[model samples]
Target chain A: MAGMRLQIIGCHSATPRLLARPSAQVLEIGNSPVLIDCGEGTQMELRRLRLKFTRIEHIFISHLHGDHFFGLPGLISTFRLLGRERPLHIYGPKGIKEAITLLLKLGESWINYPLHFHELEQGTSDTLLEAKGFTVKTFPLKHRVPTQGFLFRELPGLRKLKPEVAESHGISRAYYLKIKQGADAIAADGRTIPNAVLTEPPAATGSYAYCSDTAFDPELPGHIRGVHTLYHEATFLHTEAALAAKTGHSTALEAGKIARAAEVNRLILGHFSSRYNSLDSFRKEAQQEFLNTELAADGKVFDWAEL
Target chain B: MAGMRLQIIGCHSATPRLLARPSAQVLEIGNSPVLIDCGEGTQMELRRLRLKFTRIEHIFISHLHGDHFFGLPGLISTFRLLGRERPLHIYGPKGIKEAITLLLKLGESWINYPLHFHELEQGTSDTLLEAKGFTVKTFPLKHRVPTQGFLFRELPGLRKLKPEVAESHGISRAYYLKIKQGADAIAADGRTIPNAVLTEPPAATGSYAYCSDTAFDPELPGHIRGVHTLYHEATFLHTEAALAAKTGHSTALEAGKIARAAEVNRLILGHFSSRYNSLDSFRKEAQQEFLNTELAADGKVFDWAEL
Candidate 1:
């Protein structure tokens, strides 16, 4: 993929403030932009980042909490107001459609474009969508309400091409596609050229997993094992472990434990509680268990090249 | 009233922008703060102004448009998150209750405090609420959908007290209350003192009318006649008069004409269209028809003493 970028539009949890926003992020795989967990001020945050939001076609909501999906109605209305004609797809819990359409109906302003809803009710892992080079899967999350975590895994591509080697072996440009797909080429001498000689090995495909609004569930590591990057919610500190369990949230130390168990390459701790004035402690606590850990903030971007 | 002030949280119409927001304002009548509208980013705007929004008990929505009331659910959710226990009274169209409660239901975040909705379905002018010093009334507004204009009129108070004059007339301190209510005082020497000489004239009570998201209606002037300040929507210029009519909006010239016809002390033009780059033209155009005209901008304030 040429351009694989992850931008955090908002990262704070519970309520939005002047500087801290709720959960919202944009994951751009190649040229496709997938919105995840839109919060109340997500649109404003996107505008602040100067994002071309019209290109967004798929929206994956984590849950139906106000801080997670309250911006859906306003964003949908803005898309219609801006004369967007592309089909917009929304994936969330079963009642999301009703919650959105009710407000639109009361306003007497129906969406002009095609709006698709993929309501996920299953309490197990399920494959949601498959694009050209990536696949999206939903795994169950532990929260007060039914929630799901999304996993984006890049599909393996064809082996790397060695054009000069193929040309020197009497292969023409017309057989490049077949040669890359592991086909043998025949020369004028009637000698068979192995496909391995014409192409090099394929690069490793990367995967990203996003887990938010969940407690310290030991079962989470199985669903996102060996992912390249894992963005897990760390809403509180280890000192507030009881409160985090009561609110169905995870502590920074617990998120590190999950990252260690999953064996992910990199761990990004986000969705910090608004109570904390400084975010340095979150990183310090998570690094205790997972050395390769980072913090996610508004407008923070992580390119695939960095991974 | 000691601390009567009006703060414009967001004044632009249609879609919200980085600097320009949709319709939402705060009208502080004495110590009681009343929110005029709740746009997409009103809460953030309030935070920008450093307002203690928890003191607000009443919210008046002009219409059911997304720009008018989309922030209501988030605001209510923020109140609950902040542990607000005061009752929030919302006055709007009949379907507002369903529009708000549905989102809350889907989020599974029921408001902990008492929320009361005063649904308005009347087609004519009627009084909506009567506070200690002011009364809120609604008048019919011609729009694409059911819309109403709000008028806040300060009630007439007791006559001004002249303490020195009353004491010189041999009137006891206990008889001051009756004298201020236009009662004649009977002195201990059996002498009758006229109430007019004991009290000075009461200051003229002020009124403010908010007419937004409505087409040019000639009857609007009659509903808000002789108000001190009139805030009217000027979504378009006279050059786009046809478009303003089609969209059920008013032009700046048309708003000026209404202000002139109503004989209000001052006119405030707001809810401007995003197409206009320079707001100076709006002020110039309105001043041609109405002498005292001002433009409303985000974070602008209008104090009672200035009026």
Candidate 2:
């Protein structure tokens, strides 16, 4: 199976400044690009990065904040203007459809392509979306509004068939399916061909979990435990912990603590507050608790296979 | 009185691309900056231009399209984040207030400063706003929605007093007010002094009219007749006249016709369709109809007094 790759589009929180656009990211798995949290200038950023918008098939919106989803309508309209014919699937919380529909009505323009909206509800875990060598699941998160997180796990591959054993036993093409399924075959002379003799070990599977714009909740450890890469929000520093709690956000130290508790191999922290001009403090602060921490910057690409 | 200077911030039509932002402009009249139609990525454009946000006091929105007003919430929040204490007045059609309020509610944030909304109703004209040395009036425009165009006319200045005549007639400071009001002043010597003798002729007042995102409507000529500068929308060329009418927009030829009928000193055309890569065609098309035609490009500054 091909490994998943993550690309950071924008990571700043609240208001956009000269250095950043807003909170948006893209996940590339196989031939498809999955967008996450499209902020106000995501399309421009995509153009700047020279990414193909037509390849983006799925969009996962974390929450309903303007910084997270304000750019969606413009992007959708741009796709129509660009003559996109492919269907776009948007998985987000309720009210997203209404907001987009209202904006389109106000513009007096309708999209030419098909747009599908899947409204996610709370208390659902491991709801499979697609099962093409990987499965995408939505889990609940703690936030001021209704929110959900996503977990993507690669499915185990089938065992390879040993050609020498199969040929020697005169295995027919019809019996190859059973060999690949790890079933022992009985030959015509009553000699048994063991499943281990005919099959090799399957490839290793990897998993990545995305916990976006959520407060520090230890209960997520079980859901996101042992993930290869974990993307979490670090809106503020420890000094602004009170403000973070008040806003239903997380501090850098809190995000580090969650990564440490969840036993995630690699921690990618983003959604930084616009107040802090430099991200050096975020690295220093998060590294105090979690060693393998990486700050999310616009256009930064992360490979899951490397992790 | 100081003349009004218009600054073009964003000037793209239908959909914003990577290089272009959108259709936003700033009218700098004296010390204050009146923002017109803040499209998407406007705050970033303002930052790039290094214009002081504190100077922007009033905002005039042409319509409720996403390309016109999507940047309002971000700019408003940025102002609040920068610790602005002054109030902001936004004047637009009826649905603007609801759109802004709903966006604020969804973000779960409130502005620290006071925000006033002046909803424009249909058929309403001559609504006096700020009266420093000019007057602003909104006249009806023919568009798909309830749209209006704006006219900024410089108020006639006070008559210049001839110091020699005032000294000879023994005019008091209190009588200067009457002289400035074009009234005959009665000196302490019981002699009537003619207003013309005490004052020279005042400078001619200048005016600028903004007709954006409108169809080919000749009725606007009477409302904005003889304006010094007119910024009109030219979304298409003569070849796409049918598309312009169907989309509730105007062609370059139509814009020039409006300018010629209104007898404006100079015509500035913008809001171009994305299909035309080069703007020379629009300039040529408009100039063919009206001699004094200028293309409205991003960051182009036009002075009212110069025209």
Candidate 3:
């Protein structure tokens, strides 16, 4: 697997304000891109970021809230207008299909590409979606509605074989395959070759977990423990902790605590309330507990290599 | 009544483009400000325009399209958060109630302000809504769904009473009201006074008709005939006439033809397609038929006095 990067398209919550589009982000892994939570102006944000829409093969919608998925119909329609032929797969909660279908029925039948909808039911966690060089899973999150968080883990790479040593030992094709699979081999001439002598250790695999628009849940630590990157919602501050709980949201301190308990390498906090005039307060509050905390500003790009 | 002004808040069609918001417009008629076609980013657009949200007493939605009314829920939610106590009246097609109710149910428990819905059905054209100092009437429009246009007419002012002339004719205060009502007065002394001796003619009344998103309909001309300001959608150009018809949209030439047939003093064309890179062709196409055509740009304010 290649390096992965996350781009924050929009981080504002509730209503849009100055310089923010809405709640949307893009995860770029290798050549494929995965869009998460497209809000009203997601397409515009994608345009601003200069991202190729054709590269996005999958979209993950957290819930049916307007801020979460209002831009889906427009993005779909634009894709059709742009003459896209590739199949676009969307994984979301059950009500999303009905919401999208209702929008399509309202005289906007211009989509020419194939759109696949995978409706996720409530309380279903660790649902495997795709497995190639990497694996993707979903876990239920505590929210006002049936929302789910996504986990992405890159598959471990094959061990590298020492070509010079293998050639000197005259290793056969079957013996080379066994060596690459971390097995010791005994030759026909009674010469033994250890697996450590023929193969080097595999590269480390990295993982990213996205827990958006959810209340602070300590249980998430066990599910997303030791992830490379964690993107959590910090919609409010500690001063508004009561309001955050009442609205099924999380404060910056709560998000920091969750990141600390999960032991994630880096924490990118976003989904800020429109009431906040600036993001400085959120950064200050979250960094108090977690020094690796970073505010998820719109258009900010976070590279996994940096973590 | 004061002068009427048309404020273009969000003008991009299909999807928001080039940092412009979606399709929303503010029609400021004297002291009453009415919102037309509240799109997803309308609240932000309203804030950007520096208009007080409380001044918007009425909202007229053209259809059930997301680009037309998806911003209602967010705007309504913000209104509640702002502690607005004034009644907000919304006029739209039959499905508007269901859409708004579903959004409210998904978010807050209840709204603090009084919300009123006037669901419009077919064959209800030319129905008067308010007739205090001005008259607001609805007219049918041709579209993919059930949609209606609105016409606002400022009532004729009372005739100016010349005090010197009234005293010379011995016109009392009781007779002045009858004279202003365009009737000849008969005093208690059995003396008849001509209405011409008491008052002069009233000022010319003005009318503004908003013909939202619709295809070319000749019937609309008769309904909104001779209006001072007319807003009609120009979704496409003449080159895309076939596509416009297939999508139930109109070209700039078609919109201009309607304005020409209606004999409106000024025509404002908007709701541009995202495919077009420039609006020069729209202006040229509409100006070929209607000389007084104006392209409705975002944040542009068209004062009625300019006409």
Candidate 4:
């Protein structure tokens, strides 16, 4: 199976500081490059990381907070300045179009390229985007405002052909695809070749789930059950669980509990509040519930095959 | 005379690059700290420079271009997050309030601090702001959109009193102001004391003019005549003079001509286009016309006393 990679651009809560940044990530699944949750300085971070801005064809925003998508207008304007001709797509919550349009109108900056905005509705959980190699689904998240989590799952891979067996059977390259699709090759003399003898089984599919800026809920595990990797927000430590609940955010222990219930293979914790001086306690706290838990750091990359 | 310090936070034009940043500056005039032309990522630059964010009470925006004022909303939001209670005032072109209001409403982030917006009118030149020691005024600039330049002038200082001379003349502290206002002190017994015997003359008032994102116009020199120092945008070189005119920007030679025509003491060329890899040419070109011309670099400081 083709491996997927996730690059954590930023994963802090609230305003950007010297050490911490707001939420932003880049997920690379096969040939598709997708950007998630662009905060105030996401473009600068992306440039710092040496990521090609024009290659990011699709962007997904979790909510309407400035930390989630305030950098959209600047990024769009930059793409125009760089003379990008490809169409860019943005998937965000409602009111995003109006907000971006108002800023552009005020600056009188007309975009030279096509910009497509896909607004997600409230109280809906459905497939949001589908590409050649992967699909993105949105699930409702409980926050102070309307929020949603994204699930990226790769499609099943093509079956492998037994080259030596196919060569002995004198099968042409055009007919090999038909044989890999579980079809028996019928020869010109009306003789049939068994499909099982010509092809091998397909590889297992991989999936990743992302949940941020949301409170701990029991129903979250049901939607992302058996995910290969889950990135859940751990905004606060267990000591501040009360404050977390009041602010509609989750603690490290709470995120671990959700990951444990979901039976995911690996759990990544992110969206940490800047109040915590050290991140060692977050990993220590979450590891008590989920053994394979790790803390998310900016510019850190996670490969699906490593899990 | 009290000195003014200008901090060049960012001096590049258009989109920010790896080492170059967009337009933003911090000018320290006596006791007041003023922020000028806040572009994107300006708040981060302010933090990097270790400037006191809460101490900045006034923000002057030259125009509605994204590179000039897009950082306002983020800075305001960060101030709220940092628990600032002081009133913050913004002076900019029309539609600034509407643009900021829409973004804030979309994010549902209500500010706790008082934010006052002063919109500039087209084809008008007037005093826009007055504080304890400094005053800011606006002048028309020729850009693609409705734009303006700012003039910051320090108020005249109090006359220095000769303590022994005043004491010998039996001049009480209550009558010190009368003696300092170019007045002859009248003693209690009706003795006349010359004004020059009691106090020294006040120092000359210093002024700074900022003209950015504008084309070369002859009328500009008339408005900023005899200014102590001028920061004029030199977006292109003389080789690209035609491109500069097409884009409503000025070349280095043109900015120097304006400084020479206006009879300004010093010229600081800024808002440079990112195409020129080396900035030495900009200074070389401008210095041909105006001998005391300097390039505006990030983190470069210009002291009014030096000029």
Top candidate, metric TM-score: 1
Model 1 TM-score is: 0.97
Comparing candidate 2 with candidate 3, which one achieves the higher lDDT?
2
Lowest summed lDDT across 10 adjacent residues in model 2 chain B is found at B122-131
lDDT of 1 by residue, A194-241 (tens): 888888866667788999889999999999999989999999999999
Clashing pairs in 1: none
Using Cα atoms, each model's DockQ against the true complex is: 0.75, 0.55, 0.34, 0.70
In angstroms, give how far residue B111 of model 2 lies from its true place.
3.6
Give candidate 1's whole-model lDDT.
0.88
lDDT of each: 0.88, 0.83, 0.80, 0.88
| Tens-place lDDT digits, model 3, residues A1-307 | 3378788988888666657667898987644789998987688778867998767878998887767877787787667767889998999987666666665666445467888999887767865665566778898888988888999877776788888888777777767776887888775566898889888987666788988889989898888999998999999999999999998899999999999999998999999887788888897898887889988989999887753
Clashing pairs for predicted structure model 2, backbone only: none
Report the CAPRI category for model 2.
Answer: medium
Local accuracy of candidate 4 as per-residue lDDT tens digits, A18-115:
66878999999857789999987788889999987679899999998888877778888889899999999998889988888888887889998899
Q: How many residue pairs clash in each candidate?
A: 0, 0, 0, 0
Index of the highest-DockQ prediction: 1
Query: Which residue runs of candidate 4 sit more than 4 Å off their true CA positions?
Result: A186-193
lDDT for each residue of candidate 2 in B1-307, tens digit (9 for 90 to 100):
3377888988878678766668999887644678999888888888888878667888989887778878887788778778888999999988777777776776666888999999999657766485677678999888887778888877777888887789888888887877887988888699888898889877777778888889898788999988889999999999999999998899999999999999998999999888888989888888887999998888889886653
**Deviating ranges (above 4 Å) for candidate 1:** B1-3
